[model samples]
Target chain A: MTIKNFLYVNRKAPYGTIYALESLEVVLIGAAFDQDVSLAFLDDGVFQLTKGQNTDGIGVKNFSPTFRALGDYDVTKLYVEAESLAERGLTADDLQEVMYEDEDDDWAEKPSIKIISRAEMADVMAGADVVLSF
Target chain B: MKFGVVVSEGPYTHQAVDSAYLFVKAALDAGHEVPRVFFYHDGVNVSTRLSIPPQDERNIQQNWTALAKGHGIDLVVCIAAAQRRGLLDENEATRQGKDANNIAEGFRISGLGQLIEMGIQTDRLVTFGD
Candidate 1:
């Protein structure tokens, strides 16, 4: 099987609809296929990574933790758009620390999320073989 | 280049169908090959044969039907999404004990596996949604 570059674009907030959760579902499944998967958080999608997300009042399952586990599935290339974060008045400190074990170095865990410029995000999108946007 | 198009919104209510149609048409015009167009979420509604828009307005279902007919493209509606939205095919309607089937011509109800297959098989998988 060819290892295609799959870019899963998240442009929606976490709870209003099922898109965020479903998109995460696809990512988990896609990872099992041994594809090269990367995730981009932009626009309202930046909210998905906000720390201390509580769904107790919303009645929906809190799926924010799932994003943290994406690293185990080899989906560690998370790109959070800087412009989106700035527009939302957020910084890297406001988001959860998503990390993956680095295979090259005796399994030392490394930060998986990368705060990238919107222009850099565009280049990332252009380089993808397949882009699944939600 | 092989293109896999995914439409995830219902017709009229959103511009996803229109954008997808135009994108597919442009891709075809540009000599690109579109092997499949997968409809998911509310997009399953796009395959319903029961929709009757005003005569003056463009028929979204017919537009997809004609595109599929003209290019021999595979129009697949996600089975789970279709079932939730009541867009059943003959087999599905029979299996579910439904009274009728209303899947439009050129559109077949299938599984989410098809969507994954498209991503793996095609050169590109472009999604249009709300």
Candidate 2:
């Protein structure tokens, strides 16, 4: 199959709905195809990457740790909408630091989450071959 | 052109699957090919054969099963999501030590990989969900 750019558009908060974790499932599974996979965190989705997500009290499996494992799947490039975070009274510091190993740059560790403007996010959406919205 | 369909909501709770069924039917009527429909999240609930809607109400599972049978479309329910939601196939029920399976006709329990494959294979990938 020809390589395609697949962007997963996340627009929901974690735990309240099943969209967040299920979207993550698709991303991890899609990584096996060797396609260009990237994720966008907008609306309440920015909360998904926040640090210290404990599901112990909720009695649900905490899938937040899987975000860090994306690097191993070669699925990096998490784009967070700056406006969304601002509206939620959050900053980039509030998000968990997701890092990936730079295979081309002597295997150095690099941050995957990019805090971008809404316009840049529009451009990213326009550039993708497939936009899988959640 | 070929279209790929993803239904991410269960029947009745949301109009997603209903709209998806109509969209697929419309696409087929317009002479387009819909090779597969991938059921994810709560959408896997649509494959349960045990659901019995009122006579006045439309049988959603039957509609999809009949449509798929007539069109040779592969109706796939995600195995992981199905297992989580208690909509298992015979093989899955046996493997997981469940009492019984509830998968309806024309639907098979598969993986998320099938969804990705559909995206790669089809000219257009349309998802119907909240």
Candidate number with greatest lDDT: 2
TM-score of 1: 0.85
- Candidate 2 runs further than 4 Å off: none
**What level of docking quality does candidate 2 show?**
high
| Candidate 1: clashing pairs of residues | none
lDDT (0-100) at residue B130 of candidate 2? Answer: 90
Evaluate all candidate structures by whole-model CA lDDT and list the values in order: 0.91, 0.94
Q: How many pairs of residues in model 1 come into backbone collision?
A: 0
lDDT by residue (B4-120, candidate 1, tens digit) is 999999899999989999999999999999999999878889998999999999999999999999999999998877887788989988999999999999999887778878999
Fnat measured on candidate 2: 0.81
Name the best candidate (by DockQ).
Answer: 2
Predicted structure 2: clash tally: 0
Count the clashes in each prediction: 0, 0
DockQ, structure candidate 1: 0.49
Cα error, residue A122 of model 2, in Å, equals 1.0
Candidate 1 structure quality by residue, lDDT tens digits, A12-125: 999998789878877876677888889999999999999999999989999999988988898889999999999999999999999999888998999999999999999999
The TM-score leader among the candidates is: 2
